[model samples]
Target: MMSITFSGWEAVKDRKNLSANEEPKKGHCYMMYHGTHLQNAKTIISRGFQPSKDGLLGPGVYVSRNIEKAKCYPLTVDKKDKVVFKLQVRVGKVKKINCDNHPMQKTWHQNGFDCAWVPPNSSISSIRSGREEDCVWDPSRISIVDVACCVDPATRKELRRLIQHNNRSGGECDLCHEESDCNPHPVQSCWQCGKTICAFQQKHHCKH
Candidate 1:
């Protein structure tokens, strides 16, 4: 597991002071978090944001204005075991796509454009469908400042307890119902299914 030391958590939180205003400043620095499956947390931290089809604004990174609001996102609330990440983004240049005249009105009606996803693709004209008209921002101008796992003291304790329980109980594999062993046959819970299964059996149990 990634180290969840106090210094690490404090280091990430300290970045918030880079900006003076509560809202995104002239530098376009914003603090956001993506709530997702525990299995995907490491991938997201490494590769940066990937647009998802299930996302409200179609395929794009969705972020809340604040950490508290981010904690309320669907994945976090639905899957109590899901991981939430504190993300730092520095937008070099951004276009306001949330107003009344925005081209992607059909999907943007949700006002998701308020925190829109800027595609990495080069030209607005290159984007197919009516979405091409909405692809007004240049993604290359954006930079991912940092990504960190959000683990509060309470959450850390809960995670530790869960791991300890899994190690001690050697819970039944949700896949084959075989008794799981912690030392050699470690048990891991499926972030989506909420089932405890042998870590090696995850491939057979999870389609995701």
Candidate 2:
């Protein structure tokens, strides 16, 4: 594992000059977290993230600067199955939509803004969690840097599956072993071997 030099969480917390109605400065990069089920995390780690079709903030990837807020996601997945992804995001242009039916709640992206932000507890009707959140319009602007596993002491079955995967795919899983015909379009190309393998087989092909 590589050494981490900066604390993203703390950096965001340190911005004390902004008022409640203000949004974070745009055209800057920050560290953020996205929480999801383990199964979904695996797919994202391999195939890359896809923007949501629709949400409170419209078509974008929802993330939080607060790790605690991120941890309470899906509201359905078990704690042991939850995984939080650490990402580096470039919020190109920002818009603040703090209240319900704020006019720009769902159309911020359609505007010139690249990100929409909701301040904590701004709207009881909209932000039920009373937590700060951000919706990034461009998925390409966000990059997953690391994943924090919530599960510990993996089950015997899970451990066996992981071992088998590592052996077959060289520490890669998910996309690497999927059937070639599953997607008609090319998923991605292998980086290590420079082979044009199916996105589902990139890891497997790279090792071979």
TM-score of 2: 0.62
User: Local error of candidate 2 at 165, Å?
Assistant: 16
Off by over 4 Å in 1: 1-27, 76-79, 97-101, 104-208
Stretches > 4 Å off in candidate 2: 1-22, 153-208
Candidate 2 residue-wise lDDT at 123 = 71
For residues 1-208, could you state the per-residue lDDT of candidate 2 as single tens digits? 3422211111112323344344677766677888887767656655657898999888899998878888988677788888777776778889988888889989987889999998887873856768889999888777665564456545424533543453345333344453221123234444555544443332242344
Model 1 C-alpha RMSD vs. true structure (Å) is 18.0
**Which stretch of 10 consecutive residues in model 2 shows the poorest summed lDDT?**
4-13
**What TM-score do all the candidates reach, one by one?**
0.39, 0.62
115-193: candidate 1 lDDT, tens digit per residue: 3433323233423321211121222222333233334556545544544444345445555454332123444555665
- Backbone clashes under 3 angstroms, per model: 0, 2
lDDT of each: 0.41, 0.66
